[model samples]
Target: MTNKKMRVVTCPLTPNQLHDAQLDLPKNAKAQAKLLAYFETTEEDFVPLKQLREELGVSGQAIQKLVDNGMLQFAEKKVNRDPYAGREFERTEPLALSKEQQAANDEILLAAKEGRPETFLLHGVTGSGKTEIYLQSIAEVLQKGKEAIVLVPEISLTPQMVERFKSRFGDAVAVLHSALSHGEKYDEWRKIERKEAQVVVGARSAIFAPFENLGLIIIDEEHEATYKQEDNPRYHARDVAIWRAKRHHCPVVLGSATPSLESYARATKNVYKLLELKARINQQEMPEVHIIDMREELRSENRTEFSRTLLEKIKERLERNEQTVLLLNKRGYASFVMCRDCGYVVECPNCDISLTYHQATRKMKCHYCGHEERVPEKCPSCESEHIRYFGTGTQKVEESLAKLIPEARVIRMDVDTTRQKGAHEKLLTRFQNGEADILLGTQMIAKGLDFPNITLVGVLNADTMLFLPDFRSAERTFQLLTQVSGRAGRHVLPGEVVVQSYSPEHYSIEYAKMHDYHGFYKHEMLMRHKGAYPPFYFLTLINVSHEEERKVIQTIQDMASFLRTKLGPDSIILGPVPSTISRIKNKYRYQCMIKYKKEPTLKNELKSLLEHYQKEQAKGLTISIDVEPYVLM
Candidate 1:
């Protein structure tokens, strides 16, 4: 009657014993031999009794005869599902740590030994042995009879991270992420609740791991925007980790190459302990960066996506049998389809954005709303047959590489190419095994990639995210460039970087070229100060959406007016305007942004506003609130 137990028919005797036993054989020797042949080859310990009668053409009487002869039996067994049931990891010993890493580890261990709820901002360079410090800290935590939780930024990072942890901790590690099935997740969760798992490594949700004796929590790539849940029940894993650490009296470590402005600001203010790793392990030098201006290439009549300098570097790496990583920040075959005759473009019907043409599928897709349509032969507005695709994407770069350098092998990684389960790991494995010479990808390839042969790194278009409306665009651009640049020269071989940019003189690109995080931080802080943005003032975004534009505008206006009265006079309320890329899925969106240094009652007022719109929300109108919002659009 147990839900986890099932009745199955199993062979009680070995195949040789059954064959050797003297007995009166059935007259239908064919049926007897057929059933016996299955037992000889079947690998399963047991099969469902129903499958035996239905699939094997055997009746209950035949099975009962075997049971009576002590050859087979029906047993009820409990079902257990383990995600890593068949995988075996070789145990690894701890590597020698650098002096800076050892110093950081000592501070963390001191805090843990005293049961202090300290939050450490481990700001290390990309190749500065941050992960080794994390592992050593966890080793001490485990020795104290306490459990630990590690949160990675994305599922793409889990496979590599889990392998590292499992190789050290073995079966004591449990994985929890969206990629696992419901049953697998349940089993992992049960293992945690039952105190069977000592360490949990997974994506964001692993923060909720149920371990009563928790001692340490680690958030890798702590600055990643993916750590913030943008949807309803929104929460930042860092905040949650801090909250849980306070309850359990444990230390929480935030490890990143480029820490967020908020975290860095806090570290400067003495609110969080800061640890720095200035040099790469074993004295490996940082990659030498060269910024190539595309305008100069255009003047020279070289119109391909790759600048001459980048192309030469790629070819050099190819000839040496070293690897290369090409980052284009955008996906699809082309950014959009536009008509040369009328300046008209193909746009999605449901969203106020152009459709991206996917060369493999031969269809134009809307990145925001999942809308699709065929490419038009003639312009919709002018009825002219002069359609052309514009903008460089990963697919386009891949195509150009194949034609321009026919011998170069390229592997493309983007949302389009990595949609299937295990596709990310498979592609990365192929690249790591030296199956491909060049690794072409979008943002996912910007971090957590370590390969020894990758001596050359190229950024196809470094200005892709530099001009977004969001205030954090400059910070993000610098972080991405630095992260992708670190993929080269990580080991014994020296590394080089080629950055192709239209705005090569911009500070973000220049600082990234010099690998100067502090310079970019100081410059960006001034810009943020002038604009009254984050780390200076907190922001809350109130978004309203409706099919009717008028309704959305009116709703946002009312909310802004109501907030003006409820909040203090010092607060700045700016909005009642449409969002960038405003319309999505036929919904017209409007937002109100609230910026304040301190609004003691702001949370309560926002809750009251939601209560006032309870009826409006039920009738095709949607309202959402994001505090310390990552993306404004």
Candidate 2:
């Protein structure tokens, strides 16, 4: 619902009049009591009039009579709920940029000044002052009487990022994200709509900020998959930003240390202007990365989650009074529970996946469906009493750290610990204030964090995403490892990184150890080309799901048949097969994959398929189309 202009009513009576009115009590004791309550209890100068009448049980007539007698007075005033109402920032001035940063900033400023709708890929190494270029460019745009929209990954929108923008732009900056309350989002949106805020710093949705004179758009950490909305009305923020930039005749900046393959491909093809910042700011060295083979550790009779090298490094950091950031990328206690005696595993009845054991809750829970059950002593399937938890997670790592180094203060961050409002800020603040020796988390702590004292970074399981069914698993593993590695060695103190992986010799891990993005890109591009994957051929996934498995299959088959008859030989259509998970929340899923270089009629054909299945949808069938999905599963 649109938030219309709201008016507040305030008392204009003096203290003397209030005393006189209280001494001579009005006949409507309830209304008079509410008026006194507001005056005595609330520090707010005004209360919304509608709320006062409805919630405080104040009668309009009683208020009018009180106003007439000069015992009280009411004044209408506009009110807005400011999200950052009580926060104050120390203003910061622009910093002197290096030659590379200055050149990038100049290009961006020129584009904004000339109103050219150009897309520039700012491929800078981590800690290379990419944000400085963004700040200087936005300043130019704001000075030109235009607005800017800056998009950062939701997980990367830490207090540090928000503070830098807020300190620089002050009240002119508006933030939008899913973590904010609906009322707060509405007010922020209205602020932008009313031309009150000139710069919007938010997650993916901020691309659509209602700015009439938009000049510059920046997507930081542009390779992040979080920029894609997976649910209905699905869209990629990068695509939307470029679309809007063209409409407004402005420039869109895609800044990342590791750009997505599709985006980097476009840059290589001259579709986007490529700006490179190879060296780190202030001549700081990139973190020295060490890839430890877990297989060797196993052969040496070591069974701990941490490799010997990582544990030694952690202790070294602790002894030197430094900090460490550990990335696990998993959040629960264990990946699954299994019975060694019978080879039986506990699986979620609602979904086609095993239930994860959350040690804090002492229950096995489904990560996908929210189904929970008590950890059974005996295996439900085999009646075996040898049940055990396997695999590693953030919680498990935290527990291990406590046992290994009792004196090391660790702050564990994940979805569980950061569910509350301001939790992220509070935890990060504590770490920044030297209250914690180690910050352990999942992917959320992987990027956009700048902590000076953190000299050590560890990856407990670098192979977690290395072998997924998805084709981009290698690329994702490389990107994540590279990003997390960048977290250390960002300041005056030198930094080190320890990556533990079962597949230690994998090309992705080897390249990550060398901090070689170009190597990984070249190697991965060949794999993609050989497999006919993204950058070579665009992909579209058409999913059909229903309660009945047969019905789901039939619908996908029918759609596949229709597509084959309509499309030319150049377009390849694969599968009317079950999806990776197959069944989620008791609904069976079937998908058809479309790979084509040019199919002008594909969208219209897909729309017709949806139209044809309108009747089936009413009977519990669901169809979803993802043009360029981040996750195939």
Q: Candidate 1's residue-wise lDDT over 1-633, tens digit each?
A: 222566788886676776764235665655555566667678988988887778889878877777787777889976656767888888988999988999999999999999999999999998999888988999999999999999998887887888889999998899998878788888888888878889999998899999999899999989999988999878999999999999999999999988998899999998999999999999899999999999999999999998888888899999999999999999999999999998999999999999999999999999899999999988999999999999988989999999989999899999889888678888998999999999999988888888899999999999999999899999999999999999999999999999999999999999999999899899999999999999999999999999999999888998999899898887899978899988999999988899999999999999999999999999989999999899899
Write model 2 residue lDDT over 240-284, tens digit each, in one string.
999999999999999999999999999999999999999999989
Q: TM-score of model 1 relative to the true fold?
A: 0.93
Q: How many clashes show up in model 2?
A: 0
User: Which candidate comes out best when scored by TM-score?
Assistant: 1
Worst 10 residues of 2 by lDDT: 1-10
TM per candidate comes to 0.93, 0.91
